[model samples]
Target: MRYIRSIYIFCSIVTSVRSGASELPEERELTTNFSSMSLTKVPEGLTPITTTLDLSYNLLFQLQHSDFRSLSKLKVLILCHNRIQELDIKTFEFNKELSYLDVSNNRLKSVTWFSLAGLRHLDLSFNDFDTLPISVETGNMSHLETLGLSGAKIQKSDFQKIAHLQLNTVLLGLRTLSHYEEGSLPILNTTRLHIVLPVNTNFWVLLHDGIKTSKILEVINIDQKSQFTSYESQQIPILENAKTSILLLNKVDLSWDDLFLIFQLVWHTSVEYFQIQHVTFGGKVYLDHNSFDYSNTVMRTIKLEHVHFRIFNIPQESIYLLFTKMDIENLTISDAQMPHMLFPMYPTRFQYLNFANNILTDDVFKKSIQLPHLKTLILKDNKLETLSLVSHFASNTSLRHLDLSENLLQHENDENCLWPETLVTMNLSFNKFADSVFGCLPRNIQILDLNSNKIQTVPKAITHLTSLRELNLAFNFLTDLPGCSHFRRLLVLNVEMNLILSSSLDFFQSCQEVKTLNAGRNPFRCTCELRDFIQLGKYSEGMMVGWSDSYICEYPLNLKGTQLKDVHLPEISCN
Candidate 1:
């Protein structure tokens, strides 16, 4: 779900860049993110050279014409999740360089658009618009490539005005739609279409029309009703030459048969990436073995999140049937409450399997599940308590990345754990690990995250992981900073929020290869050792992050609450 939001934001930026603005240097673009600030009006003292301004999650009710008079170079403006009701035509007259504007989740009913000739991406979804906000007769939206509209009673005439405009993407928020005319969506010419279906609307009609023009179709169902009987009379449209290659369904409810019907619909089309989130499966807990065959389907990825079974106990047979037959290269079933994994009886070509946030234990591997081509396995937030079994189990497969974070993992014994030699990255954070965790880790591991554990110290006797590059040991109980005598190649080290009183210059000298270090939020003693550490940080630029707020002194009564950057000491103080 977080990735979905990131994709949306990334697409918004990409669309803005493709709308005629040349790519600017990373250092030249100044960005200000004021999201969730609870501001009622535009803040004062905004930089005039700012290129991106994010004011989302605020309480702004109106926008005055002089609000953005100083921002002449602003290209991206996000004012979503506000209470703005109206926009004066000249509100953005001074911001001629603005290319992307998002005012979604606002109370806007009408917008007078006169000065936004250069605007390329405009999102007005979740507003009170009953029809298209722009007037075809006078609006200057010729440069627009992306348009978002929602919470309206859409009619055939609504899109007739913009029928001639070829758009890159059309985002329709029909969750709050009052009425929708059949065949009203196909009139718009777009390469991608994203729609949020209302609970009671005829979604089939919208899907039938939307797939005709869109190469990528994303349909989100806000309805939680257990049955799809309302739209059963309408035949599910199938297109032999459908242009849609990507399909996404969110918050959908269906029975096993209805779910297969959806698969059957996409089987004939060109959908390659199919994703379903928060989907509930009802009816009997049975799946026909014959229907599970997807031999000719071109689907490459099938991701399911928060999948619920109406029955209390999941049918193991159904799970085996579906997973063994999907033939997809990547399968993700996170947060599905699955207790076990049963692989296909035959060899599988699965490259990635994510079963995170479930109740899987060590016993799941006892059956010798055959996933010979598995490369990445994410089992984070499960009920596993030991790593030896999982390590030895993956040693048989081609596993490379394993995430066992947020579990009850611990070094059950002193036996050295034998991990797959192919493993490169491992995440064991938020567990019950102690000093014994080192003996069980892979020797050749590169990236390791062991934060929020019970480890008190990094024992010098432990075997060093020479291949390690990035190590996160934050939120641990360590009293002293771990020296890089073990990880000489370490590039990034985070040991913040520890119980250290002071840092030694010897540690910095030992870990000279570290380019990034997060050793803040410690109770420093403000002594000569601390003074030398702070001086080293001052000279080595970009090494110590959060120096001002994170590296505050908490001892030596006079230096309490003072930042380490502000602390100064004389040479004779230690003598």
Candidate 2:
């Protein structure tokens, strides 16, 4: 019953509009939004014009000839997001101007490309054309720039398809077969290709081809979406594939032993960027001190985000010993809901370090890691209690950015003065500061985020940041900012989601240089005291209060929920 009514309502609206509007012009594109309409064919007498035709999100099962009798000049045809299974070659012959066609997200078994002589871009992905063969002389798709066949079962029989098409970017599904003739990969002569493999893929045999013709391959993205897992391989291949830069192992579930093997392989691969996050451990991995032969170890950038970094039975001493073996320039290791783990004391050449989403406390950094080249250190969502341990970096002059947000840090002593003198940005959000201030920070600190804290009053310590560029004090309990009078160089300030009234916007008077100001999402009093501030935020271009025109009034029962920007408040007379 509901289905019939929906179709009736849709037809009613479309027919009503179609009867009054002019015919779909020959030069204009047509978009028929029949989403969830259970449509099987194009509607009768709806001859939309050429250049483009979109029939996305429909229940189309097949495409026939008469469906496009009117679109002779159609260049781009999108039949995606439909249930199309069979497409007739005669169906597309009606339109000779076709250049780009998308038939993805369907159930196509085989498609004929002979009619599309001028196609430049073709997407046939997410289909079930498992064993498709290609033609030699008849079909000329030599002008195609991009051809995507992701999630299609591409076998050796389908290798003929690549032999003909002239594509710059060819995206294919994973292949695990062990054999490939020397001339088999001539099809990838001058194209960039990306192949997905499982985390446990035995890369030795699979890499022989890529290493032989390194320039032919581009990226080797290892993901967890595949069903195959190979654990017996030990050697990791490093190809002269100059285009292969990133080795991302996202959500790789491996045993502790496999993890070590993967790390060793990556270390030997010399790939510039390597990241392994959301790793699941299968068992314990024991490593002797002799495991790391750091004789010719190059300092590589590595990030390990085992948010569940401890599914194995291992001691912190072993972890630190193994991790510090490399000359790490940038390192990130984090875990959730674990006991406090110590930072590696050895990575002295570090530059960017992200230790966020862990169980690290302030005392963990009591002994500095001697990284004079370190620039950024992220410690957000941790268990830091105080800034007392910041003194450990007293000798460091290169450390710049430090993040301590979402921690247990409290304002006790002026220990923030001990932060590195070269520091630029700091995040101290979501702590237990109410009315207390922080005047002990370094003068060079520019960007500060004190958002989501219980700050009822603006900490007078903020004015000490004379070189501050941006400040975010959002989602607090501040009725007003009496301490913002000193922000001269501040460019951005977001104080949204607070208990702020409109009359207290006098802080903007001091922020003459502030470019972006977000004071929305607060309960406004709707009295005449808010006219200047509301008007300035809604009308003025310099101080962009985000969504200032859409905010609503919360007080005065008569005007409750009224859009604050729409309301015109009278100016109050001082007399």
Worst 10 residues of 1 by lDDT: 1-10
Residue-wise lDDT of candidate 1 within 199-295, one digit each (tens)? 7555655665666658778887734342334455524455644677777778787766567656766766677777788888756534353644465
TM-score list, all predictions? 0.71, 0.73
The runs of at least 3 residues in candidate 1 whose Cα sits more than 4 Å from the true structure, single-residue gaps closed, are 1-144, 147-164, 175-187, 222-238, 285-290, 312-317, 502-510, 525-535, 538-542, 552-575
- What C-alpha RMSD separates each model from the true structure? 7.3, 8.2
Model 2: per-residue Cα lDDT over 1-575, one tens digit each: 00101000111232234311135554245544444566777666656454556666678888877887777877766776687877665687877878777776677777664546777766665566644324442236667775656432333444555566556655443333233333333344335443444334443333334423222343343433322234334334343433333454555565556566556655654355666656665455544434755544343666777645545676655665576556577777776454454445554566777778877776566665667787787888888776646544533648788888888876654444466778888888887655553544666779988898887876544636678888888988988644356667888888888887764555657777777788778888787777767777667765666665546788888888888877776665521
TM-score of candidate 2 to 2 decimals: 0.73
